[model samples]
Target chain A: MADFSTDAARALAGPVWLSDRRAYAAAEFASMPPPDATDEEWRYSAIQEFDLSEFALLSDVRGAEATPSGMGDNVLGDAGAVIRTANGRISSIEVDDELAAAGVYVGPLAASGQGSAQLGAVSADATDYFTVLNDAFAVEPLLIHVPAGVVLRKPIVVTHHLSGNRGAAFPRLVVHVGADAQAEVLDYHTSAQGSLLACPVTELDVASAGRLSYLNVQQLGTETWQFSSHLARAERDASLTASTAAFGGGYARTRSDVRLVGRGANCDLLALYFGDGNQGLDFRTYQDHVAPDTTSNLLYKGVVSDAARSIYTGLIRVRPEARGTNAFQTNRNLKLGDKAWVESVPNLEIENNDVRCSHASAVGPVDTEQQFYLESRGVRSSEAERLIVAGFLEEVLESLPVAAVRETLRHQIDAKLSQHVEHVEHVELDELVENTELGGG
Target chain B: MSTLVIEGLRARVGGQDILKGVDLSMASGEVHAVMGPNGSGKSTLAYVLAGHPNFEVLGGSVRLDDLELLDLPAWERAQAGLFLAMQYPTEVPGVALRDLLRVSVSTSNDASEIEAAMRQEAKRIGFGEKFLERSLNVDLSGGEMKRNETLQLGVLRPRFAIIDEIDSGLDFDALRMVSARVEAATKEHNMGALVITHYSRVFEQLKPDTVHVFYGGRIQQTGGADLAQELEDTGYRRWSNENG
Candidate 1:
């Protein structure tokens, strides 16, 4: 943590409250040791290989010319507001005039005048090593606040782009939906091709009777490492939909915690991830039902090809006060390569006897019957496999809360499949070349 | 007219000899009925012709005109104008029927042509348009699954179609409707059909040009349409292995 020291944290320009908060968080981060694979929370993860010393905080002196373009190209045709950040610093932000008139704010958290009061309101209890690092070093945290009774028909898009070799970006975002308000947000993460680290933390707070839909799409470079945290809380009668579509990263992990604090509150957690090359995609989720009649459902589907791997461990905890709760968790994985791997663990801890809970998980190659069925209809073997894989992931992808980017994500998955085929062809070509040379010799 | 010739076809499944030296040949625009009792290897012959992976072909040669079908994979066999209407159609949960038809149709890039053909066939077979949007054969009733097979046969219009036990799970009305569609498709497309069934009720709607008594994994007798009525009346007792 030498590069992420107290001096570095203090040197970051911000308001007095942000400075004080970062200083305290830097002290906490300094005292805490790096996470080990032996820790229960880090089980089956690549934590042992994670070296914090290899990365330095991104420099603040990067000029506008240094900022690469196309990172914030809004695929969503309809957006109420747009915010673009480069290397964890806000480069530009634009809020629709009508949305602004309705008391919607989308800009730097420190300059929004709300200050640090709601920054850590939902994620304060997070003790994860990467989350604490994000707390200490997040340079330009943004806030999207919607006023009570306001309904945003379009989404709010926030794009974070990381650049420079070995440069780390800690992007922090807080979404606050006021009482009876309805809104949707899309958090896009992309980076240049280099050895980079992204530790992002997002806090979602939905007031009583409010509704919020948040989708996090992480498509970083294959050489980058990412550890993201999403902390969401729903009040009485409020509904929250949190979805993630993760496709890129050398070793990416996301830990999500959703707490239903008020009665009649419910939440749906969905994720769609496809890993290729030597990538490792890991996920941990916790659904906490605190009040009576609260409900939660989680569905996560993933595909691993080449030598890639994935891990999914989720838990549903229903307290005694949460009587009549209904919770369901499902994790399905498809392994396309012989060496690909997956670990799916779904647990339930029920302190109430009146709850209905169920869990399901499956890990295997593409179904032979499905393959034969498609192939029997004139589809080639490779095309049959691609179709089955796409169909296997369509369950979760189609249910994504953000509809505008669903097709783009589907195309991305198809592109990954095509690249897998190309990689195999290249390997075969290399073997052929070697054979030819040996024969000539 | 094209010919589908099967010579000395010997195959096994799970280490058991199911198809032991079967011989049959049919010309395009002709309908052949292979009637057999249970475990007579009628289905095995259909699967072997279509190149199912589980069944090991001990020795056989299937030719669709000049194309050697046995050496090809199932999809290649299909591309060579072979189709199998499975008895128990496999359910694909997330892939829609229209999508499957769109890809399986050879003229794939012409989307409207395929869509129009599928909808017309679906209507002829009494299949609802909504079923096209649903997952392929998922949660469909037995009759609906049969109709779905008939619908695909109508749209794909292969050179040869092996209808395996298509009349088993169908009710009387459904059987009549499905068989009528198959009959219409075979005549309209000049498709050679091997309609395998244990019963002759389905023939009321679909008239076979030639009927062959299949027993011991070989054709014991071949005759005209009256042969099916004779087997229906005699119950295949003379052809039974125990009786023989």
Candidate 2:
């Protein structure tokens, strides 16, 4: 597909170490077969219809042009740094003087020289086919490193703007929070106009007693296909919160894996996704507890209207040595149109009897009781459904670790509902009423 | 004064007739108490008037003065000045009471004014602003839910209110407070109210202008406020045989 040759990977202008690694990954990726729906990992995915030959790699060089106006403007008032990329090229990078003086580095991983060594440290063990592809052709990986005991009071914002016609971009980000440090990072993925492919990989490494908050917001064009990988590891007494908000993409899939490597580590994983039109959003998550007294909680909520569909499969695993581990997983979905559908599956596997684990999932249409409650209060039926769906997703949106993005995300959700509410009114109420009888209150 | 007239109101739910040719009329600033035993269609009447989707109206005419309320949807009926305080308020998670009240009182476009008005009502009802900011009816005690309903009634100030079994779960003090709020709303807004209940204790504070005995889906007796105490004293045994 599109000649992903090792020679081509070796031709890019980069450090010798990076070029050699890309060449090796390209060779490995070539030998691997493309994933399909038959594989359990790709179950319910649209991988079979994905055509890699439709796109060609654009470049390996980072851009230095001004970010297009309104492309990725700061929603948060103050930021420690702002990095902007266009079509896999770095448009600009701005770091606060104080942050830089505190030994915090935000720039190209390759420019960091020795710091580039930590690029794949956290995600190496969780590599899949797409991740391997990302390694082979990723134009330039961004790195944000906070040294020991340096707490960046403001968040670091990274915006990736994709404007390609039948082209592909591989964006990678690596974040390292040193021991006893604290950091918050926000990544925005957006596109202008083009049928494109994006394979992104993010790695988060939090050291002992460190705290990190990370959020990824994807608002790509509807003609794009996105396969993203999120890998995170927490050490002793560390805390990590990772959240994702997916609103646009023809077929978008996110695979998240979180590992508690040391005792007393804690993590919170949250996601909010809304699919309208013909969109398909799929999610797969794994929470692995390898040490004692570790805790992980996951909550994912989604809404699908028109002919859109969604699938969520999550698992909580407690290893034999992980005693006194507390794990909880929940996935809830709402289908506003009769043609819309959802599939939610949650599982738990605990090897230690001392562990506490629970899993819950629900998939159904909007609650008629809730609709009636709002209607009885003088809200029109269409407006009632809109409010209910918005309120349903508000739980996860409000809980986003980044307080600044919460209101913007909520307004985006309302905008989506306002456009689709009229279509929802055309949905057969009788069908929804029947679904109401089958659904839980 | 405005009048609400209901004539030959017939309705059924799930293939069972719950309202059978009932007739009644009331005016603004007047309060009527509908008392009966359980399963006597007291709640069915309230729901039918509110145009709940579950009920099928076989034949009826409900008019608020000259407006035909039976022809409109529930929300339009509400916009036309009708309010029903449901017995079991549905819990809508993530929707705050203040936001809901802001939407219900559609006349005011200024959100801060509505918020201030709601805050005043919340204070009068002994509810804090934080409580108003919480999800509507979620995790609320029975007394709190009833109080929340009273607060909405106060803010909405509808012309007519059909309160269904508001005293079921309230303690003595809560019942007294809720009834006093309803009385104040009636005096302030010239609101007409039809209070439905199985017990007579609520009337001790509400002081209804008239009382009607509901049985077999129709009103069997009409009298002054003493009618509630008579039924509470003797029970609804006499009206039980009317279905035959």
Best by DockQ: 1
Question: Model 2, range A1-441, lDDT digits (tens) per residue?
Answer: 486789888887789899989999999999999897999878888899999988888663343233433332445456789888887878789999999999998999999955557889998889889999989898888899999899988988888877657778889999999999999998888775568888999999999999999999888888899999889999999999988999988899999899999999999999999998999999999999999999999999999988888999998999999999999999999997788879888988889999889999999888877888888878888777877888899898888866776766787798789879766555556678878988956
Top lDDT prediction, candidate number: 1
Candidate 1 residues A1-441, lDDT tens each? 338998789779898888888988899999998888998878999989988899999865364222233333445457888888888988888788999999999999999878478899999865577788888899989999999999999999888888888889899999999999999998988887889999999999999999999999998888899999999999999999999999988899999899999999999999999999899999999999999999899999999999999999999999989998999999999998799989999999999999999999999998988888888888787777888888888988888876887877887898999987777678779999999999999
What is model 2's C-alpha RMSD? 4.4
Which ranges of candidate 2 are over 4 A from the true structure?
A60-76, A425-441, B241-244
Q: Which residue pairs overlap in candidate 2's backbone? A: A63-A89, A63-A90
What's the DockQ of model 2? 0.69
Candidate 1 residue lDDT tens string, B1-244: 8999999999999999988788899999888999999989998888888888999999978999998899999999998888999998888877888888888877546999889988999899889999989888888999999999888888888999999999988899899999998888778888988999999988998899999899988888999999999998888888774537
